[model samples]
Target: MNKNQDYEIFPDKFRIIMTGTTFAFFAIAIGAITLLRTNFVWKILAVIFAVLFMIAAVRIFKELWVKTPAYVINATGVTDNTQKVPVVVPWAEMMKIEMVPNNAVMQIGILAQKTVTSQTEKTHVLTKNLFTNGNMAFYSVMIDGFKYSKKHFLAIFEELQRQGVQHNPKILVSGYNVGREK
Candidate 1:
């Protein structure tokens, strides 16, 4: 158990910046390429997609500028601030924590006794029985390009689950090829 009960995981700014820049680049490239086309409907569709991507890029950059922790776990609960719809599930509500692999990404899926929602909004509970199909989670954190290693992040949660909280929620290891981590 760590001396400090609170664990805060910040996003890697460099990676975030790169991702945002890529989105922006694509938006510009797509819009520019479509300008050469004569089809009016195609141009409209391309412009819409470019605008959407630009919006996403702007949001990402804004989040990076804010510099908030992507994930936080403490004696009280686990808070996921990765998405626009932030969710905080207390230890008592959390039933299981699992490592769900989706392609090249490893996501920390927090399964609660019920659907966990944001303070204001009612977010959907996204899972189907132990997450066998790897559909979604009540709350999931993508562990790609974060400052810490996947093993370290998982270890922190495991330690917190064992020593920090009282409910003793199970932390299960799922998915294939779990040992590999960079």
Candidate 2:
């Protein structure tokens, strides 16, 4: 038996699958929206958004395709195979991890950049992915009335909390969006 088989459990498959399916649905939705709406500006925007959404959906599906069989081994530290962030997070740092509700609200900080008006410097800025999952694992960032079955949200949150507790770390718990709240 593989020594790491214990921690070799898969990531949140349902979320991955749901996200992929939703993106594909969105691709269709935008096309229909454009058809129903007669504004030229809206048409142009819809087509652009649809194309970009399709491309991103394809990319996400491809990544998940290969990552399904992967696992999160937690022998000394937790190594998440499914997520793209730091695969291996030491127990200490993981304990310090906290989720900021409405994280995109932090982007409001960027607007301040306009007021700074720095003319001589450039810095690498990571823009929020407005169209992506909206960081669903922490549901407060979700759009209003966005729905997910209770089981789905419970499963993911519990797993993360389980891991956090197992390694003697703390997990950040936040409220869900109004319509999506348990």
Candidate 3:
């Protein structure tokens, strides 16, 4: 695909399937909880789990219903359309692109000249605590194995590097096994 051309990334089928399974499991759990023997603590726990599970299911359903592109890449920059307020990262603001290894999964980290802003920025911080070790405010894009294999993601990453270089010769692009320590 041409780097200058716009491309829309959709969520993987595996994610949708897993989300459906989770919703079904939670729905069943709610039913099972009502049938459990009398126990105050168990009932309280059930209520908490029910609420959390329902929220998760609703969020997943909303994502499925919206059918919006997860990410958009073009000549100007990359836009994350998945957030409440899409984040537009201009090419000049992109400092570096690194592939960070995490629990056998690799994520593409887009380091920016300054912190990127989004409506869900705070949510990113909370989720980052689970996936990253550093405190930097770069944007992280997870490549779903079911949607795009590792090789495919790497290719896109390389293309992004090429685009960045074409747009801004000084921008640093690394982490494609070049052995530059992070």
Candidate 4:
């Protein structure tokens, strides 16, 4: 495969700040729970929340420590290296390419002509359901502002269009609107 360009979705200053804040919140919550004299049910809930938040904090910390490219878009296809098992979506199999607004960030959604398999499917039914979005099968790639600006992201989309894939202009516009609204 001819790898044309490589891009790294590095965490921006905003992301770093958010991650630090979340971690601090969780740490404080855990400490408060420990110090407070609560009922059994409340204690259990506190433990659960603490564990979940700790996990999330650890994940974010790992990402921050390990700086790697989240994805690699090549001449033939795009490969997602973020997951344990890399997902490679070939250009020929791409049915649609559009911008999807997610949590104040614009993500590039690549829908395949057929069902694309990934490591998540082997884990649980719920995971597969969440990833597939109940039949609308596609992969979402976050375009980090630190790594790529809107113009660069759009240029990449234009290049994909040149490869014969058509994107939904409405979706793209809506994504931009969402960014503006935020």
RMSD, model 4, all Cα superposed?
A: 6.0
Error of 4 at 150 (Å): 7.1
Model 4 lowest lDDT segment of ten: 166-175
Candidate 4 lDDT over residue span 83-168, tens digit each: 66666666666655666555444556665554344556634433653454434333443333333456555655545554433222
Clashing pairs in 4: none
Candidate 2 contains a number of clashing pairs equal to 0
| Worst 10-residue lDDT window, candidate 2 | 106-115
TM-score of each: 0.66, 0.46, 0.70, 0.61
Q: Per-residue lDDT of 1-182 in model 3, one digit per residue for the tens?
A: 65457866666555666776688688668747857786878777787787778777777766665567877767887776745667677887877766666555566667666444465865764476344534433454333333355555666677777777887777777664623332
What overall lDDT goes with each candidate model? 0.62, 0.45, 0.64, 0.55
Judged by lDDT against the true structure, how good is candidate 2?
0.45
Query: Evaluated with lDDT, which candidate comes out highest?
Result: 3
List residue ranges in candidate 1 displaced over 4 A: 34-37, 82-86, 114-123, 126-176, 179-182
Runs off by more than 4 Å, candidate 4: 1-4, 11-13, 102-105, 114-182
Best by TM-score: 3
Name the regions of candidate 2 deviating beyond 4 angstroms: 1-4, 34-37, 68-71, 81-87, 92-182
**Model 3 ranges off by over 4 Å:** 115-152, 176-182
Check candidate 1 and list the clashing pairs: none
lDDT value for model 1? 0.62
